[model samples]
Target: MAYLRLFDWYQTNKRDLPFRKTDNPYHIWVSEIMLQQTQVDTMLPFYDRFLTIYPTIQDLARADIDEILKVVQGIGYYRRFRMLHKGAQYVIDHHDGKLPEDYFKILKIPGIGAYTAGAIMSIAFHKPYPATDGNVIRVLSRVKMLEDDFRLDKNKKKLNEMNKELIENSNNPYLYTQSMMELGATVCKVSNPLCDTCPLQEVCLANINNVQQNYPKMSPLKTKKEIQYFTFILEYKEGFLMRKRTEDLLHGFYEFVQIESDSLNGALTQAQDLGLEIQILDELQPIKHVFTHMIWQINLYRGTISNITSPYEIVHDFSQVPIATVVKKQIKQI
Candidate 1:
């Protein structure tokens, strides 16, 4: 009865997001993959552009990886896009471009995890599988007054069981899934939740006990390790020198020559070792870029040189280089 009430309330009061309008497995899978670590507002334009370019699984499967990367530029996590490309190809080759309706079969895709599989099952196939993302976890913890750490595997198992039960009893599984996410996003927010307007306020455990902030206990975050980097803008009469990053961190992206050192002098020596006659042009401002687990303190050094030769490609325009967001910003500022 309580679950039905929540579902009923959700039917009338859900946000109209683009992904919620259709049950197309392709659309749902794309949106779910894009929204992994990205916020809704940031993803809106990108999602529209992506769908416009490659509207079907076949289109994406046939497209080149470089072309796809160009479209998804400015969105972080390049590896996710690569995996998505692989997944699309798999769908096209194995499933004839039709996404599988079975939950377990869909989960077999490279990037599709439990949350994504659940979302596709409920929204696309109308199956009773719950998508337990961060928002849902927060809402469930607060509503149930769970004291255990939400990040633990034991708690995750319990939460998944609770979610499965909720879905099984839900009158409309699609609406129920979206409603839970909507409530967490709008009413039962992380901080300063609108408890007065919340539909579940009457029975919400967090609100009744006045411990909303304490119910969803989060694990302590690890400190970001900082590293100093010196990036050189090596310009000659013809073009600038840039190299492609071929490793896991930022593979397939282009950036200016970077040297890891504690001091600027050490970076200069390293540059000279690369067989380039270095002439210091101007010292631009230092830039700080933070990744998920790493912090980079980058110092920008510009110089004009002649007779520079290396494996790097020389491009006349800096913007044409496929640099990462952090390196792109640093180049723009210089």
Candidate 2:
């Protein structure tokens, strides 16, 4: 009864997303990868542009990694793009230019984890696999009145076992998996859930006990590490000086020279250490950029220099360059 009602609700209410128009594993894989830690609306433009650029797995495999990153630049989580490129190449080399249907084999691909592997297997291949994402976890936790810490491996294992049963018993595993995820995303949300409109409200243990907000229990959130950045957007002639990072974060992404210092004096000291004669034109409003675990308090400064004294790429046309999103915002302010 629960599965039947959920499917019926989904069929009538599901959003007509581009990815839902096909059962192709390749398209589904792209959507799932982009959906991670990103909102659907935020991903729509990137998804459409991405598919337009690389319409097929073979096309993706043949494309350059830098090109792929350029396409997905502002969307962030560049590592996912790297994995997508590598994984597509792997498929072309080993799987005949097609994504593997087997769950375990999908898991073997880099950046393709249990949830993503399960999602592709069930949604694209109609396999009886449970794609247990955070949405599924939330829905199931409320349905069963579970109170275990979600970060614990034992709890995740137990939840996966329960989802396995649900999928195995489902008459249409593909629809069932999508419907469950849809239900959680649209109705059974993390806060202020629409319990009255939820299909499983009648059987939901948390709803029955009037504790819907407390079922999916979790530990308190961690404090974000605070850091300061002094961004210097120095212009010489018609171009600005930009450089690619060799660090783990935002690797290969272009940005204006930034000094990691909290005070103006420190920033000036670092800028002088670069051995470049620069004149400070004016200061701009500070910008704040937040990451998953860190908060960047950015201090923006725009200036001019007579010549390029440092080894930095001179970018005259941004259309041809893939600038970091954080730096892009700063440029807009100038």
Candidate 3:
């Protein structure tokens, strides 16, 4: 249908990305995983550094998880990096250091899901399967003007079926798959689309009906739950005290000595109970950080301790802590 024409157009117009030049499944898989929920511009440097350090699946599999986390420090979603490390080990140990060509086997890995598997299969293996990511979903929904919410099961099924048909009918499945993604990213954008230059504009229902921006209706997002955290930047003669968050939210990451409190006075009392000599150095302005489903209002406190026998351990170097950007910024300001 219209995707065939778009595919033809893409062969001449597609951007030259590093992953497109090689049929190496390891490289393709790594790029695909990093590309998820991360912009290409932001991922470029990280991808280069990652490939330089861990050139193969075996290298990544054998590398320490903490080292990998350190390399991918600011990218956020620390769990994805951990899962990638685990998945690499799984592939090497179970599949003999080679990525599995079979779709089901790939899906069995710790973090590889349907979309990632589909992408690797088509791009690396030249399979006819389509990668139904958010970009593909947007392109299809606007082309056919699907009214149902895409997040719902029924519409998702329909979109998957349509994506399969589109890929199966195309002569060059790899080019077609990449084309659909490129079209959505460059021309058929989420907000203000360049419909005039889109190859599918003639048949696109959204363009013909003049409702390109309104197609693919989305459900309202749930409001993020707000949490107030009192961060104590307790400094001794040698260094400052910090802790690694072991919880699921920011697991394996570092932060300042933090205590959840409803008010500032309560937080100070709690810190005093922990035997920390409460000396207020400075009360900085409140800092706000947002996660996927939560908002954090962190209040920073800088104080020095004469006695080094408190529960908090002193970190001599700031670079050792795998602190997120928000905490790092706060520390820098203090």
The candidate maximizing TM-score is 2
Which of 1 and 2 is ahead in TM-score? 2
Candidate 2's C-alpha runs over 4 A off are 309-311
Q: Which prediction has the highest lDDT against the true structure?
A: 2
The 10-residue segment with the lowest total lDDT in model 1 = 315-324
Ranking by TM-score: 2, 3, 1
Worst 10 residues of 3 by lDDT: 304-313
lDDT of 3 by residue, 1-334 (tens): 6756797778877888888888889999989889888877888888889999999998999999878887888887878888999999898789998988898898898888878888888888878877888888898899999888986767777888888888888877788778988898888888999998889989999899999888677888889999999987878776887666778877777777788999888997887788766687988777999988999999888887665444467778877667778787787876
lDDT of 3: 0.84
The better-scoring model by TM-score among 1 and 3 is 3
Better of 2 and 3 by lDDT: 2
TM-score list, all predictions? 0.95, 0.96, 0.95
TM-score for candidate 2, residues paired by index: 0.96
- Tens-place lDDT digits, model 1, residues 246-278: 888877787777889998888878877987767
Each candidate's number of clashing pairs is 0, 0, 0
Residue pairs of candidate 1 with colliding backbone atoms: none
